[model samples]
Target: MNDRDVMPAFDMLMEELDAIVTHLNQQGAQLMQAKEYAQAREVIVKAEAVLAFQAKVKALQEEWVRLSVSSSKKTPRKKQPGQRVMTTMLKQGLRTPNEAFMLPILQALVQLGGSGRVIEVLDRVERMMKEQLNKYDYESLPSNPKELRWRNNAQWARLNLVQAGYLASDSPRGIWEISEAGRALVLEAKE
Candidate 1:
């Protein structure tokens, strides 16, 4: 019987279970809204099962931690910023593709405020996305190309951010400001 052989697989399963619980919770919310109590209840029961499995996984984590640390040869371990960014973003309620894009932009917007820096960052991001993305329109922009791109992406991001309570916008000034949620997201990204 090899205990170490099963440790990584168990850890992977724990992560999957955690993600499943989050998904079930989200789906359960929609079901509850639709008044489908039966479906929501089923989801809750399944989530409980996952939680039970995780209790076992947590006990196994002790063994895995010892194995990983002892085998590393190096004393102090360092994690990269990108890995930290992913971990923090995942810890928050960002579990969607649109959220993957929108959250970073929201965070950036929150940091770079009404100053010219905000426009610069937006321009840089829009340029990168436009270059990377195949189908993007350039015509609908205002006189400035920077304004054009911001007009497009910021407009879409504005609706989403506002709905999520992360941003405030004034149509007359074409300025966007971060709300409390946006600040929280930015801090999460920083961490």
Candidate 2:
């Protein structure tokens, strides 16, 4: 179903989940009061099932967000007569290669001793890209005026690296770090 349909379903699911949680809580409380150990265990098992369903719903929401972000598109603006176009390194589009940004991000993390804030890493990646890749500029997606498309690619690369066990996810908010595997990957790539 489309988002329009899914949204209502999501809301309904949330309501159902809330009701289930309330029921579970009440039942557990009652069982505790009666000191019914066996029934309490059953309630605990039911609570686990509720948690599983909640997790599924959360996963669905996350997937929706990812798909929506990646599928976003923007139309290019017509340049005025005197308007100079930005650097011609690569044209803007969904086709921009993310691989070019990955190594630079990894290298930036290594230079920072394998950990840093996201924005700091992003700036480092940009500088490295300009110097090493000769990528003077990248076009921004239509949905964003101040953001460059390659930056998004870099973020995706970071996510992929995290999934590949090359980055750690336990850092502070807005912070990322290279795992031991990432350092090894960098060394291997160099060789």
Candidate 3:
């Protein structure tokens, strides 16, 4: 039989086994009432076949479940590091932060004439983030906390983008600007 047939056979056999046992109990009682001891022994002997069938069906069902579970466990999943980080960050919704800050930060620096202090850039990014909030890209907080989690990720995004030559850092800690490379990136992305 095909696997589909085998799966249903497990449930069908158990049901049929139950009906057999019920019928056997009634037959055994009737034989006993008639004081037919030999016939009652025959009834018990008849039930042995059904009982054996039940044992075999039960074993088959157990084996199916065991194999199904083991096969599922054998398969493994792989994800990129940034994708993994984003997944973790999204799960921290209502508790932590966003993976949505990078692009907005880039756009914000460009809007500010391709340069701004870190705090000013962050402020512009936050406003843009709020405008996009209805998109449900992030979880809402009770209040805009002083320490926004996405803001922290934005800083990390800035450092990484800078290293990648997308942005340039000035000598002072908070000042930043989009590099010519960063301008090209923004232009390319717009297309």
Candidate 1 residues 52-141, lDDT tens each?
878878877776666664342345447765442111112212222233345556655654762224455466456545544332344333
**For residues 39-146, could you state the per-residue lDDT of candidate 3 as single tens digits?**
988988888878888898899799987776422233445666545211212222332222356567778889999889989998898787775543233433223335
| Candidate 2 vs 3: which has more lDDT | 2
Clashing pairs in 2: none
Query: Model 2, 66-179: lDDT tens per residue?
Result: 776432244667988867554322322224355567677888999999999999999998787774443323657444568777777688777757755668978788998999
User: In order, how many clashes per candidate?
Assistant: 0, 0, 0
Alpha carbon deviation, residue 140, candidate 3 (Å): 11
Q: For each candidate, give its TM-score against the true structure.
A: 0.35, 0.48, 0.42
lDDT top scorer: 2
C-alpha RMSD by candidate, in order:
15.4, 15.4, 29.3
Task: Tell me how candidate 2 scores on lDDT.
Answer: 0.71
At residue 134, what lDDT does model 1 achieve? 30
Query: Candidate 1, TM-score vs. the true structure?
Result: 0.35
Query: Which residue pairs show backbone clashes in model 1?
Result: none
